[model samples]
Target chain A: MHNRNAWAIAPLMALSLAACSGEADKSADGAPPAPTNQTLAEVIADKGEMDTLEGVIRNAGLSDVLAGKGPYTVFAPADAALGAAGSDLSDEAMKAQGAALLRAHIVPGALTRADILAALERGGTGGVQMRTMADGLLTFSRDGDAVTVTAADGATARLTGDETVAANGVVQPVDGLLVKAE
Target chain B: MKRLIPLTSVLVLALCASSPALAQNGNGNGHGKGHGAGNPVQQDRDDDGDDDRREGRRNGNGRENRAERDVPRNHRSAEVRVREIVGDPPREGERAVRELRRGLERGESVVGREVIGPRRDEVRALLQGCPPGLAKKDNGCLPPGQARKIDRSQSYDRYNYLWRSFGGDGGYQYRDGYLYRTAPDGGLLGYLPVLGGILSTGNVWPTQYTYQQPPQYYSRYYGLNDRYQYRYSDGVLYGVDPKTQAIAQVAALLTGQQIDVGQRMPAGYDVYNIPYDYRDQYVDSADRHYRYSDGYVYQVDPTTRLVQAVIQLLT
Candidate 1:
């Protein structure tokens, strides 16, 4: 009777140990588990900065596109960058320029922050030009810790702060307007 | 002396003969009250005078009524009507005269009201009937010529309106008689001008284009006060001042996001507080995918960077 009881407890202990080890393995893998079908709005909601980006997004006229099935990389401009653009950035003006700039910042495919940083680090003579969802080209450059982007029209804007990784793509805050080439 | 006496007697006889008929009509006889009791000729003369007086009063009253309607009650100036018609060669002048005459026949009051209180349809009709030269002009009116020239000029105004509406220089270049905006990206965030183009198609009514900016109460959560509030739609953002709640409502229609009131929103979403200010900040979390703050909720795209969805939180 005692031998039989020991055998039953042994199996239970072994199963528990295996479960612990599996959890440990998952933690060791630094990647965050994949999030399902989360929208850009949902992601921003988590950060508590949706209001700041909302105006810029609306001005860019990309609300629908961003809400759509987009694995889009958005080079979002912070409120400070937007303020620095001056009072002339009226609603009408933003509406006029928002779509193009938003398109310029976005790439249709998912690009992790790691990928962008790596691309910037591997700088070549030609620099890296990523095709935007708008069919325009966005050029990337790196100066030590700072990443600079020269839009299609040679308008240079600097990327600021840490790169945020979302399920669909990456978000890097930018300072200044991204002009599209004619 | 005998001849003078005979002339006086003839005059007296004539006066005596007409006196009875005049008295019968003038006395307001009870018989006259029933239509044909009085002589028809005398009644007809009196009726003609009364009709003339009534016609004069009507014309005067019409002008007064039109002036009151055209010029607002607070505005003191009398509104005047001015219609210029553009025609080709000698016929152009004739057409202009004819239109002016027609306008006159329509009554000055009507013309004045049409000019002062212009409607979208009226403007459209005017543009459609514009002469070649007078269709579009920088300061005054365009001169009449080929229909193409008039059409080009009219279209130019539409483009100018689009540019001005989007906060761009109203000047548009005409290349080979085609109007185009020179900016490569074209206006504000590259959305306004394109929107203007779409609007110019005239499929939608002008009254339907009532997009306002977002309100200040919602800006507190995002740390944006009056400076940055704007609306986004159709892949473009519009920058408007004095952001109103209506903007958020319109944005919801454009973006397919639900902006409900009184809901506990996610950390980054917009929230409205009474007595609006710019300093309101709330704890941001990655779990809550939507939030309502500053009279609008920040709609998030869960698939992108945690902050990428912030763009949709706009006015």
Candidate 2:
């Protein structure tokens, strides 16, 4: 039976499961090099074209979560692409909606270009289907040398730029925002 | 004296009858050997990794079936073991405790089955001092006439009642809409009225908890492919990709009605096919496949539709 104590114990479980210990980067003792020189949130903020997306993340109250020791991959949207899609980035009341939209582009754990390619090779024609944090699925398939991500509602986006391997994760610049169509 | 049969002759006849029974047992053993040694076709099939141990009784008790004879009288199968637990009140509640054991196969997940094990002895103890007419029901010491009729309304009302206690109000406490044993304890024990008892609560006050709560990132439990970082706090099960670090929630757990493992999820249950893209977490069943229902993934055998391991999603 779930009681008050059981509920209180959940975060402690998370604390235990945070297996990545110490600093993400190398130290004086010469540990393995970090995935990237900076954390994921810092990497996102440093990106010149990801200003709108960065604003959205901040508005969603997720700046700390994404920045904190997260191993999350953000298939972040380009400014021009966000504009082309006509996404409402300025809406004040759509904070929750903004968070949901952001989650559609994100996945848990660190997925690099090599990982995606390996997944494609393993899955073949059916492609690699990844569950999004927003409770939807994104199917990844190869288009020539470029990779494309398709949503459950059939909306598609292509990975446009070199993946920014961050300290905690990767920030992939996509040509289009990975929003699921209604 | 001429009409009466002699005592010595009767004894001899009884001995002759008993010999055939032993021979019958021996013949059953012989048949198993004959199939293994003589039949090349059957031997080849067994070599293909047929579960001979599983089909032992049906295969006429092979040479390895020594437990049936060598076992002590105290050794009982799960069925008999459950039946031996005497909690005959609350009418169907006691029967349900036994049914849990009967429903499970050796290979299947026992997460749901295990829910009843600890309570079996507790119920047995409660029945020891039960009143003549009154029996254990609704986890209380009551008769069939006084048994609490379970319904969604009652379950809700019981959870909301402010007068509830850990050891008061019939030796049971209501928590997270499930019945938990109080300090005193009472009655026949079983799952909730609908099934699967109640949904596991989030890591805070149930009221304060909601799926909308931001996902908690973890480096353990359920994953898609090599991605093992898990997110289960929102009551939705998600796997974090090892490379990208993006978490994907298995969407089916968000909406499907929860059902316990060991019980066959009815055909009507919304069964989501675990996509080929995500690597198998609990198993890679070449002979069978995995399915996602409610909040858990299950390795289900296609031939028997028996749900195997319920993928562990919690700490």
Per-model TM-score on C-alpha atoms:
0.34, 0.38
- Cα error, residue A32 of model 2, in Å, equals 14
lDDT of 1 by residue, B33-92 (tens): 111212221111122232122110112222343222342332221111111112221222
Task: Provide a comma-separated list of chain B TM-scores, one per candidate.
Answer: 0.18, 0.23
**Model 1, B197: alpha-carbon shift in Å?**
5.4
> In candidate 1, how many Å is residue A174 off?
2.0
Model 1 Cα lDDT, one tens digit per residue, A1-182? 99999998998998778757745322233332234345564554444443456665655345554554344557776665545332222244334344434555565334444444554444454556664433345777666767777756576778765445554444666776565222
Clashes of each: 77, 24
Question: Which 10-residue span in candidate 1 chain B carries the lowest summed lDDT?
Answer: B20-29
Instruction: Please name the candidate that would achieve the greatest lDDT relative to the true structure.
Output: 2
Q: Model 1's CAPRI class? A: incorrect
In order, the interface RMSDs are 14.0, 13.6
* Model 1: lDDT to the true structure: 0.34
Q: Total backbone clashes of model 2?
A: 24
